[model samples]
Target: MPRENLPEGFEFVASLPDPDGRVNMTDEIEDFYGKLDIDPVDPANISVGIYQWADPGLAYDAKITIIRLSDEEKADNAISNFKSQYDEMVARGLPIFSNATVNGHPSLQIKDVRGDNSIRYLFLWRAGSLVTLVEGNQDRNQSLELAEAAPL
Candidate 1:
């Protein structure tokens, strides 16, 4: 992820470590796919960037992960699968699933309530051969703002 394009008041924190030398998907990846009930597609490359708001009053953090597939076709397929799965979730009475256009790319905005009652916002979209997932501990609008500011 490019640091310069981050939203105003957001600062790059660190680059999270990738799963080490595994051909199969990691537990984290499996859990993410499990939530959507979709098979995980192994990415050719994965990049994770962590960011935090500079304002002391804001208690939100964003994690942006870009997964580059072997080709655009796979990227497209992955994004489509995510959209379909999210649609199913909405049909099952899940709250806060919507389609949006962020930075000119079609994105799915999801708000998930954890077991602890904490809220998480996710923005999923595809750009060329890259599939981006942005997760934040914030409101829907703030999550979209971060996704829009992201340099895909």
Candidate 2:
């Protein structure tokens, strides 16, 4: 399925394949995802899309995590939780925090307070019954543009 709303000249991948042309998810990726304090909506099925340039490059990579909640109420709760999580992070001295809109959906954008530019951008928003999270190492403007193009 064509999942995320990626901009022109971009596509989605199931996962980044290793040299063996296989996706090692459960053992490798899941653990790291778990470590991240910000998690996708819980107890809901998820569809993941790794966004990349059609021309391919390390610089043009991002991820979209779509959490399909079972009900509208669940989606609302998830959004609330997500906001609280980010609020807590800000309270803990996380510097960059901005609220914006992406294609009509309310979006929250955050960056590292420590001035580390490793993670260029992170965007979270709730659209209908889906809670979407976007992460990228690309430029902030590019990341926001990708989020704006999201199907949400």
Candidate 3:
């Protein structure tokens, strides 16, 4: 469908940039993977529905701001009115879960980020704002990049 064909709430936004442009983050990852003798599919292909620019529709029952939270900030906020994303991960029996830390992008308030043992995919989620990205296998690298790329 044409760009204009999409409904107001359904704007088109590819996870990777268009082929005509050299801006898709996925392309960069592909290039890096090629050199490593790996394929993009090798990584867990985690993804959230809406792209960065597209309209963030009614993802959650109510709209919430995508607070660019840091690891430290998340913890600080956790003291009050914070949800325990890790608790869910633990319940799901995630074997390869990487608990969010304030190591890098210190202002990223990622609600939930973990790997699903059953599907062998990594899931990075931000609830209240409703942004979920799932990467399977080696695709988890994408989540890492996205988290790092966030304006934390």
lDDT of each: 0.68, 0.61, 0.32
Backbone clashes in model 2, listed as residue pairs: none
Better of 1 and 2 by lDDT: 1
Q: Which model is ahead, 1 or 3, in terms of lDDT?
A: 1
lDDT, candidate 1, equals 0.68
Runs in model 1 deviating more than 4 A are 17-28, 31-44, 53-61, 80-91
**What does candidate 1's lDDT look like per residue over 65-139, in tens digits?**
877666777776666655555565578787767788888888888786656777788888877878788886656
lDDT of 2 at 74: 65
The estimated TM-scores of all candidates read 0.67, 0.60, 0.29
Please write out the lDDT profile of model 3 over residues 1-152, one tens digit for every residue.
12333222334345333345555444333211221222222122222233222335522111111222234334234222232434465677754344553224223333334244323223344443222333222233433443333322
Most TM-score-accurate candidate: 1
Q: Rank the candidates by TM-score, best first.
A: 1, 2, 3
Model 3 stretches with alpha carbons more than 4 Å out: 1-49, 52-65, 68-75, 78-93, 96-103, 106-138
Best by lDDT: 1
**Which 10 consecutive residues of model 3 have the lowest summed lDDT?**
59-68
lDDT of 2 by residue, 16-70 (tens): 3334535443322241242224344342255556777546754555676667666
